[model samples]
Target: MADELTTRSALQLRDLVAHGEVSAEEVARAHLERVAATDDQLKAFVTVTDDAALAHARDIDRRRAAEEPVGALAGVPLALKDVLCTKGVRTTCGSRILQTYRPPYDAGVVERLRDADVVVLGKANCDEFAMGSSCENSAFFPTRNPWDLDRVPGGSSGGSVAAVAGFQAPLGVGTDTGGSIRQPAALCGLVGVKPTYGAVSRYGLIAFASSLDQAGPIARSVTDAAHLLAAIAGPDPRDSTSIPKPLPDVLAGLDDGVSGLRIGVVAEFMAEGMSDGVRAMVEASVERLAGLGAEIVEVSLPHAGYGLAAYYLIAPSEASSNLSRYDGVRYGLRVDGATTEAMMAATREAGFGSEVKRRIMIGTYALSAGYYDAYYAQAQRVRTLIARDFAAAFETCDVLVGPTSPTVAFPLGELTADPLAMYANDVYAVPASLAGLPAMSLPVGLGEAGMPVGFQIMAPLLRDDLMLRAARALEAEVGFDAMPRGPNALAGAAI
Candidate 1:
């Protein structure tokens, strides 16, 4: 029974805990054990809070026993990406610089999770300061894909996806600056949502491209993702960017199928450079959705081709500004020197990873005196064009669909030496981010090596429900199994 608990979905576990059929502590233990059993190989978590989780579970159990009202996700364990600040818990944004810094207050999303009675098992790993397409850039360690240990689990949100896919947790929260959440979900065979910007509050999230970063859910099923999203989606005074508009229940019309909905297939997303295996898988999913009564049409996003170049400039520029606070004087790793300036320089040189420094340099240059108009301003203009492209496409389509990642999970270290190759992974996933639209990656089928392929679904601004409805519809038809088969690291995890 304990081993079987790990296979259950978040909703299933929620029901079991809420009904008192199983104590919350028991469920927490089952997942903690799974993490202990597999984390050494997968490197999914930077810190495992077994003691904290068990205590949280006991509190939930006590509430249930006392017949007190509980939140929507009572006693469910979740893997929170380390980028979000958690009160008293070390919030290492997968970097050594802030490795020891613990926020005095919980992030807005963390507050929501606690209110929802979610148990956070640990701090999931990520690319340092959420800056890479692959998890290999983490200062602590790289997260290995559960599908094949030799391969990479897609970037910054890889740890969150790894936990759910490896059965270490049934739910997780990850941020998408570019495709951090959806890209990782694609490689790991899970459902990942990048909610429309402002749909979820960004307060207390360690800044990383503040304009683009959004916290969303990673789960094995569409409904599970909706439940998680609802718990954290709403206006918060703490986050000025949070939507002031009242949020509708995210799960209200979730299961309603996509019949009569027009799903636009982005032509730019299907262009050359997509692997044959991935192309075939996405093409087949479009056919299946058509059979399910969704109107399929090919739409062109001509400006989308420039999304990559613009994102690189905008994200890094914001990062350069946000990261300037880490200059030795503030809490975190500090290296002393004779002068304050020397100390700050030495500290940053020692604390930050190579990728972070690279981005900082790029961003600093783009924002420099002479280059501002030519680079950053131009990039912002390009961003506007990309948003216009999406707006034009949405006029005739209910939701846009395409391959999330150009290819299935690539082997670890294959593209590490060539950074440009890595940047290309987000080609299909970036335009939606640039447009501030609600987007998701749903497991469609296996591609090369029997690994998972994710079908991307995007909806108009503030119409997250529409995208989810389309995803649920196609998900019902494709029915991809998400169990990992990567050697003995987490083999038979679902069992």
Candidate 2:
């Protein structure tokens, strides 16, 4: 019974716990046990709050015993990416500088999780400051894909996806700046969503690129992701960029199939850099959608090809500004020196990893005095053009479709020495992020190397529900298996 608990979806656990078939404590314990059993090899978690998680679960059971009303997600397990502050829990942002730093208050989303009664298993690891395309840039360790233990679980949000894919947790929260959530979800063979820029509040979320960093849900199924996303989506006065309006009821029309809806295929995305297996799977998924009463149309995003170049400039520029707060002063690590300037330099030199340092330099150079207009301003103009491209494409279609990543998961350290090669992996995902659109990566089926292939869906800004409906409609048809079958997966697990 305990082992079976680890295999159930978030909604399954919630129903079981709500109906008294299984106590919340049992559910939490089952996943914690799985974490203990597999995290050594997967390195998905930076810290495991076993005691706090079990205690919270027990409290939920207590409340239910007294006939008290519960939140929407009353009893389910979640793996929170370390970038979100958790009050007493350490929020490392997967960087060595802040490894021991704990926030004094919870992020807005964390507060929502507590209200919803979601049990957070732990703080999952990630690329230092969410800077890299692969999980290899973490200051402490790398996260391995559950589908193949030897490969990366695409990154920045790699650990969050790893935990959910490996059955250590049924749900996760990962921020997407440039495909951090979707890319990892694609590689790990799970579902990951990136809400529109202002759909979710960013208060207490450690900023990477303030304009692009939006946290979303990671789950094994689209329904579970919708549940998680709704619970955390709302306006917050603390976040100026947050949308004043509320997100619609995503679950209400989730089962509304793709009949009579137009799904646009980006001509640029399907034309290049696709591996044979991934191309085959994507084409097949599109055909399957067409057979489900959806109109298939070809759309062109002329400026889409420039998304990667613009993102590298804009994201790093914001990162360079946001990360300047860690100057050996207010919080986190501080190395003492005779002069204050020397102290700050020494601390940063030791605290930041190679990738983080690299981006900071690039951003600094781009935002420097003379080059601001030439580089930074030019990139913003290009970003506007990408948004226009998306607008033009959406004029004729309800949603746009493409392969999430060009290829499936690659072996760890394969492109570590080649930064450009690693950055190219985000070609399909960066465009949507640049446009501040709601996008998701849905697991179509297994592709090259028996790894997962992601069928990405993009909807107009604030219309995340359309993509969810489209994804759910096809998810039912394809029936992709998310359970990990790797050597490190839980015993009895199958792909």
Candidate 3:
């Protein structure tokens, strides 16, 4: 019973726990067992709060026994990407600098998840400071792709996706500044959502890019992602950037289906440079959606060509400013030196991974006074143009469709040598983030070398429900349930 329980979704687990088929304690214990057995090679977690998780589960059980009303996600387990602050837990963002740091308060989302009765299994690994496109930047260890250990798990949020794909957890939270969540979801063969900028609160979340960072969920299925989003999405007074609109029940209308949905396929995404297998998979997904009554039309975002340059300038610029707070002063791993500035610089140099340093330097250079107009301001103007492009495209369509990543999961070090190539992996995704639109990656097919490919769906801001409905529709049609299989305990396959 415990073994079978690990594969169930948060929604399914909730039902079982509510009906007494499985206790909240049993669900937590099973997930804890899976994490202990598999996380060594997967490196999915930086910290596992076994005692606290079980205690929370037991409290839920006690509440149920007392006949108190239980939340919709009661007793289900979820993994937090180490970027989110959790009180009393070491919330390292896969960086050595803050390995022993414990946040004083739970992030707004963490508090809400706790309120919803979701058990947090642990803090999952991520690219240090969420800088890299692959998980390799983690200072401790890289999170291996669940499909093939020898390959990379598309990242920044690689551990979150790997945790879900490897069945270590039913739900995982990730942030997408520029495809961090969706790219990993694409590679790991799972569902990941990046809500419109400010759709979810960023308070207590270690900032990546102030304007673009948004925390969301990675799950095995679209509905599971929706349920997790429903739990975490809402305005928070603590975060001024959080949208104040009431969050509609995302899971309420899942059965509405996707007939008559206007889903536009961006010509820019379908153009040359994409892998043949990825193209075929996306084309097949479009056809499948068309068969389901989606009006597939070609749309153009001409300025989309400039997205990479603009994102590179904008994201890093913001990252440089946001990361300045970690100067070894107020928190963990401080280094004393002859002078304060030297000490701070030395601490950062020794603490951050190479990717983090690269971005900070790039941002510092770009934001310098003489270069500001040439880079930062120009990038902002380009951002406006990109947002306008999406607006114009949305005028004729309800949603947009394309491949989430240009290619599937590449090998571990394939693009690490070329920073530009690494940034290009986010080609299809940055446009949506720049526009503050809701987007999701749905596993569509296997790409070259049989790695999972994701079909990205974009919706107008605040219309996450429409995008999710369409994705769930495509999910049913594609039926892409390609989990890695063998006698390797699923651990060896992922590690």
Q: Write the per-residue lDDT of candidate 3 for residues 1-495, one digit (tens) a residue.
A: 777777777789999999998899999998888888877767788888999999999999999999997777999998899999998889998998888999999999898899899999999889998988899999999888878777888899998888888888889999999999999999888999999889899999999899999999999899989989998999998999999886666887776777998889999999887899999999999999889998989999999999988999999999999889889899967877789998998889888888999999999999988999999999999999999999999999999999999888888888889988998999999999999999999999788887888999999999999999999988988887746643332643221
Clashes of each: 0, 0, 0
Q: Name the top lDDT candidate.
A: 2
Candidate 1 deviant stretches above 4 angstroms: 486-489
Per-candidate Cα lDDT values, in order, are 0.91, 0.92, 0.89
Candidate 2's error at 462, in angstroms? 0.8
Residue pairs with backbone atoms closer than 3 Å in model 1 (clashes): none
Candidate 1 residues 464-489, lDDT tens each? Answer: 98888888888999888888864533
List candidate 2 segments past 4 Å from native.
486-491
Candidate 1 CA-lDDT value: 0.91
Instruction: Judge candidate 3 at residue 351 and give its lDDT.
Output: 85
* Tens digit of per-residue lDDT, candidate 2, span 1-495: 777898899999999999999999999989998898888888999999999999999999999999987888987999999999998899999898998999999999999999999999999999999888778888889998888888999998999999999988899999999999999999999999999989988999999999999999999999999999999999998999999999877888999999999999999999989898899999999999999999999999999999999999999899999999999899999999899999998999999999999999999999999999988899999999999999999999999999999999999989999889999999999999999999999999887767889999999998998899999999999998887665543344311
